[model samples]
Target chain A: MVFTTAVNFIRARGPDELWRKRRIFKLAAHFIGRKRNCYSIAVRYVHRALVYATKGRKLKKLDMKDLWETRIIAGVNEHDIDYRTFRESLYRSDILLNRKVLADLAAWEPYTFKALTDVAKRRAIDDGLASINNEHKVDGIITRGALTKS
Target chain B: MSALKRVQQWATFARIWHIYDATWQNPFKSAEVVKKFLMGLYKPIYHPLNDCGDHVIIINSGEIALPGDEWKKRVYFHHTGYPGGASWTLAWELHTKDPTMILKKAIYNSMDGNLQRRHTMQRLHIFPDANVPKSLLDNVSNQIRQLRPVPTRLDRYTAEEVASYPKLIDYPKDYIIR
Candidate 1:
């Protein structure tokens, strides 16, 4: 289409408006009432929903982290170890397992989790971490400090 | 669904019965382990909303060990809801009143206080001794391992076994046998 004059061209809105409205309408299709068919109302709700969707993505990660922490705490507590000390001991021993995988091991593979706790306990003792009880002795673990002591 | 798939589905959702020996085990420590089974935290398909917990039968609760002076130091408080009706009971007193009360309370307190807690506690069956009913005993298909090894007392060793144990040094001939 050709514009007869500069004024006509200036007055003509681009075809992009139709596509934009169509996108918002499609998103509001599941919305109740006139929000699905009416452009003005649909756009408002659609924009709000998109904002919530964006925020929800971030919240999902935080919720999962909290859940994994709870699970790890529960798992380690069963072995008479607190979650902080367990993670610290594991980190010191060069076992860099993240919370997600650790939580999975704690739930799906209990024996493996128990073994991990034992390793963490041994490492804690070797490092003389303050939280650990000195009376609780774990055998068969020879650490760098132990070797150097003799 | 095929017959095999149907059976697999049933197996996946089946509630398993587990038995735990509480002999010589710290009640509080044992409670954490028991709570895992009760809440089905050990299952791969566990969810807070899912009803996937299993049955746990704890035996020999009468022999549970308390660390330090917990028996005398720990106090359980109760109120009758009337004026001056509050009372505190020592852990040993409570134990004497009910051999299973200490362990029962330990497990009950171990879980999060929620609406599901009472329902989950229903799945727990604690026996003061090893005399579980045959009906419940028959359903136990798994055993929850003790958190710590039960040490054998000197009296538990036979006379011959005690005599045969290698000694680093023999007692002086003049030393009186206690």
Candidate 2:
């Protein structure tokens, strides 16, 4: 298509209006009633849906973190260790593991998780960071505090 | 699915009954541990939407220990939907009223308040004493370990064992009279 003047060429939209509306209509296909058929209405709902999708993506991560924390708490509690102590002990021992991996270990690899908790418990007891009520005695664990006392 | 695979699948999803001895255990602390089994959080296949919870039989709830002065300080509140029908019961009073009520409330409050809360609670059986029905006991193949070691009371210890116990220092004869 040729424009008669420079102004006419500038004013002409690059793509056909039909194609522009089709993009939005494609997304709104599953939507009900006028929102699916009408271009103006479809565009509004599509924009809103896209916004929700964007927000949901972030929310999904937060929700998963919460879930992993819950699972880790449950796993730690099973071995009579509090979640904070377990994580702290692991960190102090230089056994770096993220919550996702820890949660996975707690669920699918329970025995491995138990071993990890045992290590954590020993470390916690040695460091004197364990809860008083735990009262679990770990053999062969000596810390700076004990060495200085002796 | 193949026959062996079918059996494996059934085993994966099968509900297991677990027994927990709550004697000398802190009810509030035990509730946190019990909630996991009740909700099947220990299972790898656990999901909020999934029906993968297990049945938990809690025995000797009457023997549950309250930390510090909680037995007298902790209050359980209840209100009837009428004018001035509210009542607050202390932990000890509530325990005396119903041995299982404190533990039951602890487990109930431990979980998130949702539609599933009540349903999940249905799987928990709290017996005041170790008097659970044989039918329920027959179903239990696993025992949930207590969170803390049960203390041996002075009266519960054997006289010979107590006498043999090593002491750092002996009390003076005159000081020991009290």
Best by lDDT: 1
Tell me, what's the RMSD of every candidate?
Answer: 9.7, 6.9
lDDT of 1 by residue, B67-163 (tens): 9999999999999999999999999999999999999899999998999999999999999999999999999999999989999998999999999
Taking all chains together, each candidate's TM-score versus the true structure is 0.60, 0.66
Output the number of the TM-score-best candidate. Answer: 2
Residue A90 displacement (Å), model 1: 12
Q: What stretches of model 1 exceed 4 Å from their correct place?
A: A1-60, A68-150, B1-10
Candidate 2 clashing pairs, residues 3+ apart or interchain = none
lDDT of 2 by residue, B60-164 (tens): 999999999999899989999898999999999999989999999999999999999999999999999988899999999899989989888889999899999
lDDT for A78 (candidate 2): 70
For candidate 2 chain A, the 10 contiguous residues with the lowest summed lDDT are: A132-141
Instruction: Mark the regions of model 2 whose C-alpha exceeds 4 Å error after superposition.
Output: A1-51, A68-150, B1-10, B170-176
